[model samples]
Target: MPSFINNIVTLALASLVLVSNVAGDKLIFRNRSDQVRWIDFTPNTDGTNGIGDVRVEPRQDVEFSMDGYGPEWDRGRGWRGNFRAHRDGAPREYDHIVWGEVCFHCDSQHPEFNTFDVSVVRDPNTQEGIHWMYPRGDPGAGLSGCDHFPCSTCYVNSGDNWQTKTTTSNDIYVEIRNS
Candidate 1:
């Protein structure tokens, strides 16, 4: 190969490595509902992501970094949390809407693994449901039948111990819409 072509290839490979090293993994939330929605993240005592409610306008997208949760050692160790979505003007209570519970990087055997589940356990007997899809990354766990009320895809009671885990380290892109 030509010297110039060799140099160019080396630079391109170096650039790709640099970008991948600095680019943090992400959790993207895209709202396809017509109504505005608010996302509330309640992290563990030492976990991050407690920046109050995040508003997402209709047909909009919001991205969140999956990093910065818990301390340096705990980053890959374990961090549990819950995040819920509510319509505009809804009271800031978990019982008023559907929610999701997550255990980010909580696998002791493999810290890269994460467990999560959607639930209506705290709901006030309302007919609220949410639909989520991983368009970019796969968690490699759980079933998806969240098409209607009382969805079989979610936990209906606190006793529901069912959960799913992400087996990959790629950026996760989830689209949540009203159902």
Candidate 2:
């Protein structure tokens, strides 16, 4: 390539590194629910999220640093794929005892947290039920919403015929259901 082109490429590459180092990994947690929800991201190693808690106003998309819970944590490690969310609406009625307890708590694990916006999508439904307690990024099986390993635990992670991960990261989204 030409010298000018080479220099431009070099600049772009350098900028990406700078941003990754300075900004670190982040996730766009969009709240599509009708009520506001308070989010508490617990780092796998037990660090509090920014401000010790995050509140995503109704119908708002917020950016969070999964870069560990506190200063002592792994700053580069993005969201823990876990949350303690509280909404203002009445909790939905369900049949199973586990769903009642699980959704009521709004806590779980999955590696889907590490995905980039390009390949992940959070729909109105279908996400992992925060299955299997562990660092989601690690190699292992996960428990889905139905007590199955690696399945749709929440509506967000569920992909339908209408969409795919490459098209939108909407399924990778989260919501604050009424408590």
Candidate 3:
């Protein structure tokens, strides 16, 4: 009877520690529903409105890269995978979540011609949201940006059918948190 009681207490304590540890490291991704469409580059170019560019400032001690997964260019257009960070010259996998937002762009002669999906990646290790800024409406304009972590590069595929214009350039910003 005494041995059984002791075992139960030990199990309960162990479970509590495990639960707390897991909860502490968990991260949540917040998707801003307000989709801002850019119409003109000159006036709308700012962080206040539109899908901004990716910018990583100073760079992070560790660098990570983004890869897209799933059907080439079907419904899962923004499904990103393998955001690997470097540690001691080796790649380490960080737990992350991807959320979506809308992007509006322009073409040669047409105004407000293209619309696509944008995916934002968040690292569970850091509790900061990535910040991006771009002049509203101009998808082809140069993007100015910064981030908490150093972002080396990002790859985007314009699905399977269209390969003419798939990837774009932008500044990436990473937000880092101690806790």
Candidate 4:
């Protein structure tokens, strides 16, 4: 009886550990920035469909310093990244939960929208290449309009163009979590 009880307890503990680890891998994004920033996310591929790589484009703008610092000196800047799918394979459709925003800032000083646009696509025949877009605005909003096909395009008016001109090292955490 004693041995049987011990086995059950051990099994319970092991199950708990496994559950925690799986939960931990559920995708997390952290904001390591010192100032509040704005961000946007767009899906680049149907990694959710077990397709190719999952790519995300992150566009950010750190509000100009409240104090008389010129916009050129503002520490806030832009970023573009591609996050590969988790080891469990592509995320499920319902698991698609994208969330991001100004992690920290000196207050809502800048009113202009600091957003990120993204596009995801995969080639059925050729897995050798991937296509993407930046500053893809809301489709229904008709802000930037939607591209009929996937391409390597960037939105100049959407604030993603800042990366082409300069680099801002500001820490902005953007993440997609599966619930």
Candidate 5:
């Protein structure tokens, strides 16, 4: 009888611990940039679904709570990533926008979003960046992909260019802004 009582107490204690964790944990993001940007998420915690593209307006933020992780020892590996801006423009610029991406790599899983350590960047050779810039405001770290795609072939468009730039953080929430 005593052994059965101890087991019940153990289970009750475990339930309380799990409930406390869920009640107290949450992820937060702050977007301080002036332009709209996109963010993507890949959680090792949940291997089933990919958190798709997220659009964050300037000075806005978003967040997610930590869902229960997979049963693997490596679940919830750290997350960090690159940024990009896309919009209508010359053929090369448009093509650059369409192709601008930073891909995450994985094993036994589809590749995830590549995390970053250094400042936000635009590498033409790697074909990744937030390369879209206004005629007046240019961050300058972008692909000259425009040089390759003829401006004449792609109709020029004066539409809003959207981008997603990531700042550094721990294994939890990630900042989604250039600043």
Candidate 6:
């Protein structure tokens, strides 16, 4: 009887951990540059839908929240995508970022947690630009990309672990700088 009771308690604790891991997250994008920019999210090949492009003006910000569940996709469970910034009349920028990306109950080794990251793997206009992102209040928890073409903190390749994962609720912040 004691062994059965222990098993029940362990299952309860595991369920709690899973709930905390899959909870929704809030994202805040701040444009500190000198011009307005539009941010677009291209969902991963998983078929998860995302909101339309977001517009943030200079010295301004926008907040978005997503439930880390449902909206079934081809391969994953939650909404996942890469956000790219673009100028009004100019071309699309290559610096990209992602937030609230998790494949629920997948990848035991990685533990599907709400993750965020910035990348410059395809930075075409790397001549002069800076992009960074991190969980609010914890600058050390995130990374910056495109500061100088191929920054080590940025995801320049598939082997990079620039992505930040969170188990607790927090605000993810992103900043775009054009020079």
Give the best candidate by TM-score: 1
Higher-TM-score candidate of 4 and 5: 5
Per residue, candidate 2 scores C-alpha lDDT tens digits across 1-179 of: 69999999999997775335324344445555666765544343445354365677877877765443423444333343335444534242321111111111011233223322111123223222222121123333222232332234422333422211111121233333332
By TM-score, the candidates rank as: 1, 6, 5, 2, 4, 3
lDDT of residue 104 for candidate 2:
12
Q: Against the correct fold, how does model 5 do in TM-score?
A: 0.39
Q: What is candidate 4's lDDT per residue for 101-120, written digit by digit as tens?
A: 22112122532223333323
Model 1, C-alpha of 155: deviation from truth (Å)? 0.8
Winner on lDDT between 2 and 3 is 2
- Superposition error at 6 for model 6 (Å): 16
Model 6 regions more than 4 Å off: 1-24, 68-70, 73-77, 91-112, 124-130, 162-169
Full-model lDDT, candidate 2? 0.36
Candidate lDDT values, in order: 0.59, 0.36, 0.27, 0.27, 0.34, 0.57
TM-score of model 6 (CA atoms): 0.65
Q: What are the per-residue Cα lDDT tens digits for candidate 5 across 1-179?
A: 99999999999997774444323222334455566656544343433344456566677766544333222353333222232333212232333332222212222243222222211222223222232211112233222223222232111332212232222221223333331
The residue ranges of model 4 lying beyond 4 angstroms of the native Cα positions read 26-179
What digit string (tens of lDDT, one per residue) describes model 3 on residues 1-179?
Answer: 99999999999997774333222111111122222211111112222222122222222322222222112322112222112112222222323322222222223233223222222334423322323333233456423222332232211222312212222332122222221
Residue 133 C-alpha lDDT in model 2? 23
lDDT tens per residue, model 6, 57-171:
8788878664542345422334556666566555654343222232233444544544666665564336332376666666545455545546566666666664444432246
RMSD of every candidate to native, in Å, equals: 6.3, 11.7, 20.5, 20.3, 12.7, 5.1
TM-score of 1: 0.70
What C-alpha root-mean-square deviation, in Å, does candidate 3 show against the real structure? 20.5
In model 3, state the lDDT of residue 142.
26
